[model samples]
Target: MRITVFGATGGIGRLVVQQLLDDGHQVTAVVRTPAKLPLTHSHLTVVTGQLTDHQAVEQAVSGADAVISALGPSLKRSTTGTQVTDRTRTIVQAMEAHKVTRFIGLATPSLADPRDRPHWEHKVLPVAAGLMFPNALAELQGMTEAVTGSGLDYTIARISNPTNKPATGRIRSGFLGHDKVASTMSRADIAAFLVAQLTDSRYRRAMPAISN
Candidate 1:
């Protein structure tokens, strides 16, 4: 499949891009600076541009079979600084213009249905974090809303902690607020799970959570 990735220089984004290439898919890595990405594949096309720019996103996404966004900072300060969700909005518009479907985004567990979370933990940790990072969470929420509202075939993977460890190919994914929640997952696993989603039929319009 031909794929386009925004924030392709981020931790999870890079892994996702590499994994997509390893899986034999043509990948277009969109970023502000192409020199930062460590890609050397003939199938990998590095496009330099900012995610916030509409024309740049459209240029990267054109002719792609699917578009995946794994853009997020490991340590976030304010929602205003988060670009993934905002970038996603532009992506949605571009994809529609380009007529591309199948959008897979790396959202957070915070966007999961409130009722699905474990009650006690929900009230304390996750819920508190949601309030604390309203903007950050909003980005994910906005992306999900935009995708769903855009009428695209979307799968929002609300992931837990994404570590940089080797890909184990094993992790747990549940609806937001699932009782058994772990705090982390290797970035490798996240990327692999994303690749698997390209063909998975069970996750349409659903938000699936992942953790180690």
Candidate 2:
């Protein structure tokens, strides 16, 4: 598979790219700063560009079988303020233009999954998050809406706090409401699952929460 990846420099995105390469898939890693992705592989092609740049995004998306986005705001990058929705819209439009179907991206539980019967922590945590980080919650909600409405073969993997741990390659995953005890997932495991979804049809068009 030829895959285009946004947020290739992010914690989970880098691991996803590496795993895809290990799986013998062609990877186009799109990023604003090419140097941030310190990997060199025969199958990995680094494309330097911003997600909001349509032509850049198209270049990355062209000839790709799937697109995976782990995009999120970085505290160091002050310019990335609530731009996930805008970026997602641009990517979806480009995907439509190019006739690429599969898209997998990240989201949080704060977006309100109807199927999710909230655990006590789930119910109060997002409210606290909203109070502490109103802008982030709103942006996440916007991104969720954009992906859900894109009408493509899209899956939004909702995760909570991600840690830097080895990839266990095992996860408890289900649709938003199915898992009530999930609180954290390792970045490696999340990347593993995202790459697996490239060919898996079970979770197509679903927002499944994954955790260790």
The CA lDDT of each predicted structure is: 0.77, 0.84
lDDT of 1 by residue, 1-212 (tens): 99998778888888888889888999998878877797899899998877777888889889999989876633464437546667778999999999998898877665545347454434565576666765666666676777878977888777756677887766787665454657689988888888889999778877777777
Highest lDDT model number: 2
Q: TM-score of predicted model 2?
A: 0.92
Clashes of each: 2, 2
Tell how far residue 139 is off in model 2, in angstroms: 1.2
lDDT of 2 at 7: 88
Tens digits of per-residue lDDT for model 2 on 1-212? Answer: 99999989999999999999999999999989988999999999999887878998988898889999998754232333667878988988899889998999988766655566655656776898677677677777887888788778998888878999787767988755456437688899999999999988988888878788
- Runs in model 1 with CA error above 4 Å? 73-75, 78-83, 114-121, 176-181
**Cα error, candidate 1, residue 38 (Å):** 1.4
Q: In candidate 2, where is summed lDDT lowest over 10 consecutive residues?
A: 73-82
